[model samples]
Target: MGIVVIKLGGSLIQGLSNTFFEHINLLQRNGKKVIIVHGGGPLINNLLLKFSIPVEMEDGLRKTSNEVLEVVEYALNGKTNKDLVIMCNQFNLSAIGLSGCDNLLLEASLYDKGKLGWVGEVENVNTSLLELLLTNDYLPVISPIGVDKIGQKYNINADLAAKSIAKALNAEVLCYVTNTNGVLNSEGKSIEKITKDQVQALIESKTITDGMIPKVQSALDALDEVQSVAIVGENFLNEDGSMNGTVFTKGVVFSE
Candidate 1:
C-alpha cells in the first residue's frame, strides 16, 4: 500500500461531516495508507484571545511568539490532535496522535527567529517510527510542532510539515483538505488540473490571491517531492471516488 498524507486545517475541523470520515475509510478500504497532519488556528486564536494575547499572522503563516507557542501547543497537541484521534477511533480507524517533538520524529531549527518568531522549517524527518506505525496499519495524526537540538520547540506550518513528511515517506500524494473547493480560475471556478508552469501563470495573472495563493504555492513546492498534490474541499471527495479539486503535477496534468 502507498502512503497518502493529509494536511487538515483546524478551520475545517468543526465542519467535518460523517461523509468525510467515510471517504477516509474508503481510501483505507482501497489499501491506501493514510497519515494526517493537522492545524489548530481557530482554536489557538480563541485561546490567545481568552488569555489576552494578540494573534499575528505573516504571509499566511502564524507568527508564533514564545507566549503564543505555548497556546499553539495546547491547541494542536492537547486539544485538536486528541479530538481527531478520538474521531478516528469512533470510526474504527485506530489512530495514534503524535507530535513532531515526540521521540525526535521531526527535527528543526527556527525558520526566522526575527521574522516569524518561533516558527520552524523542518530540517529533517525521522521516518522510522512513522514507517513502523504504517506497517502496523495505524493512522498517525500528527501535531505540527518541531523541537530543536537544544530542546527548544517551534511551531510548524501544518502544510509544510505534511509536505516534508510526505517527501520523507515517499507518499503517493499529499492532499490539502481545506474549506474551499480548490484552486479557482479567474471566474471563481475550480480548475480541474494544473501543472507547475500553469501555477506560475495563474499566480502572475493574480487569479490566485490571499490565503488560497499561499496554499497552491505550498502544494506547488510539495509537487517536486511527492508524485502528485491536491487541494480540495472537505467534501470534494465523493462516495464514487470522483473529486473536485485542482491537482498539481510536475509535467502536464491529467485526470485519473
Candidate 2:
C-alpha cells in the first residue's frame, strides 16, 4: 500500500459531510495509507475575534504574531485536530490527533526571515513517527503548527505543510480538499486536468487568484516528489472509487 497525503482546508472542515469521511474509509479499505494535514483559518479567526485581536494576512499566509499564535494553537491543535480525529473514529477509521510540536512532528524555521512574526516554513518532518502510526493502521490527523530546534512554535500554512510531509514520505498521491469543485476556468467550470505551464498562464490571466494561488503552487511543488496531485472537493471520490477533481501534472496534455 502506498501513502496518500490529504490536505483539508480550514474552510471545509465544519461543512465536511458523512460521505467525505466514508470516502476516506474507502481509501483505507483500498489499501491507501492516509495522512491528513488540516487548517483552522476560520476557527482561528473566530478565536482571534473573541479576544479582540486584529486579524492579519500576507498573501495567503496568516501573519501570526505571538498573541495570534496562542489563538492559532488553540483553534488548530486543541479544537480542529480533535474534531477531525473524532470524526474519523466515528466513521470507524482509527485516528490520532497530533500537533506538529508534539515530538517535533514538524520542525521548522522562520519564513521570509520572520517578516510574518511567528509564521514558519517546514524544515523537517518526523517520518518515523508518522510511519509508526501508519504501520499500526492509525490515521494521523495533524495540525499545521510547527516547532523549531530552540522550542519556539510557529504557524505553518497547511497547504505547504501537507506538501512537505508528502515529499518527505514520497507519497503516492497528495489531494487538497478544498471548498470548490476544483480549479475553475473563466466560465467557472472545473478543468479536469492542468499542467504546470498552463497553471502559470491561468494565474497571469487572473483566472486563478487569491488563496488558490498558494494551493496550486503547493501542488506543483509536491509534484517533484509525489506521483499524483489533485485539488478536490468534499465529494472527490466517484462511485468507482476514482478521484474527481482538477488533476495537476508536470507536462501532460490538458483535457477538460
lDDT of each: 0.86, 0.92
User: Which structure among the candidates has the greatest TM-score?
Assistant: 2
lDDT by residue for model 2 over 1-256, one digit each (tens)?
5999999989989878999898889899999999999998889989899999998886688898889999999999898999889888999889999989989999999999999999999999999999999999999999999999899999999999999999999999999999888999999999899989889999999999877887999999999899999999999887986668999878855589
lDDT score, residue 210, model 2?
71
lDDT of 2: 0.92
Q: Model 2, stretches more than 4 Å misplaced?
A: 252-256
Residue 29 Cα positional deviation in candidate 1, in Å, after optimal superposition: 1.2
Clashing pairs in 2: none
* lDDT tens digits by residue: candidate 1, 1-256: 5898988978988768998788788889889899999988889989999999998886578888889999999999898999999998899998999999998887988886548899898989989999999989999999999997889998988888888899899898788988778888888898888887888888789886655666777788887678878999887575666565878867855789
What range of 10 consecutive residues in model 2 has the weakest lDDT sum? 246-255
RMSD of each: 3.0, 2.5
RMSD of 1: 3.0
